[model samples]
Target: MPNEMNKKQQEIKEKMQQQKYQSKVDNVTPTPPLLKNICWAFVVGGLICTLGQLFTDYFLGLDLPKKEASACATAVLVFLGAFFTGIGVYDDLGKRAGAGSIVPITGFANSIVAPAMEFKREGYVFGVGAKMFVIAGPVLVYGMVTAFIIGLIYWIRQ
Candidate 1:
């Protein structure tokens, strides 16, 4: 009975020590400013979308059809994203804007180009070409597969 009692006391003491350590760690840890992060994300994401809209408008003004204008705008945004990423501007923006810079098509472009750029020093064929799709490859594959399945289902329903 004394042995069991001593064992229980040891267990309780260990738990108390763990709780004390956890409290100290929690006190030292800095909390993130959630509201500030959300605001930055919202503003940056909005600006990217607005830029896409402006590109679409400019293309439409040039007499392109609505579909073509939208496509051109997307292409422009992708090119801009890749260009900004290549020049290292996009990484800085991403740091400040967080997910704001990631939810847009520009983010998709960054995803593709960033990996390629990182591997470029290893040579074009083995490095850039191989790693270019490291981040975006799975996304593209799943997206295409999902689209094909959806189309097939729709056709069957019809």
Candidate 2:
């Protein structure tokens, strides 16, 4: 009888503690305003696209082919992203710009370099090489798969 009584008391104590924790959690505030974040993201993303277009236009003025100019512009944007991330500026931009910074090719560059930097202390091979692709691996795999599938569909159509 004493054992059963003790067990019941323990259960009630646990239940009360859970309720207390849940109440605390409920009292905590939520994330920032969604509309404001969306606006920032839109603006930042648009600016990046505009910058890339300007680069492309500048290259075109040099008489480069359209495709070559566009590719060069993409390369420039990727370099800027990686460079900023290396200097620790991209993270700040990411925090404020949110998806605005992430929806661009520059964001892809950031993802690749950020992990390598973080894992640098773990050693070059194990730390940097192994973990560098953690963020990009899924993205690359899915992107390749999507491209292949699209290509296959196009081939079949033709």
Candidate 3:
């Protein structure tokens, strides 16, 4: 009975020490500015969208149909995203804009290019080409799967 009691006490003492340590760490950790981050995300995301719209408008003015214009705009945005990522500007933008830089099609381009660039030193076949899809592969897979399921459901309803 005495050993059991001592073990329980020791456990409680250890838990208390852990809590004290956690409290100290919490006190030392600086809190992030939530509102500021949100604002930056909103602004940056908006700008990217605006840029896409501008591209679409430019294509539209060239007598392209709306669908084609939109597609061209998306391609342009993706190219810009990959280009910026290659030049390292996207990383800096990502740091400052956070999810703002991640929620757009450009972000998707960055996700693919970034890993490929990182692994480029390993060679084109084993590194850049393979790792290019590492981050985006699952997203594409799930997206396609979800689309197929949803399409099936819609067809059934029809």
TM-score of each: 0.79, 0.81, 0.84
State the C-alpha lDDT per candidate.
0.96, 0.97, 0.97
RMSD of 3: 3.0
Residue-level lDDT for 65 in candidate 2: 100
Give candidate 1's error at residue 1 in angstroms: 25
Per-residue lDDT of 36 in model 1: 91
Candidate 2: tens digits of C-alpha lDDT, residues 14-64? 999999999898889586889999999999999999999999999999999
What is candidate 1's lDDT per residue for 22-69, written digit by digit as tens?
999999999878899899999999999999999999999999999999
Q: Which is the better candidate, 1 or 3, if ranked by lDDT?
A: 3
In candidate 2, the residue pairs with backbone N, CA or C atoms under 3 Å apart (3 or more residues apart, or in different chains) clash, namely none
- TM-score between candidate 1 and the true structure: 0.79
How well does model 3 score by local distance difference test?
0.97
* Least well predicted 10-residue stretch by lDDT in candidate 3: 31-40
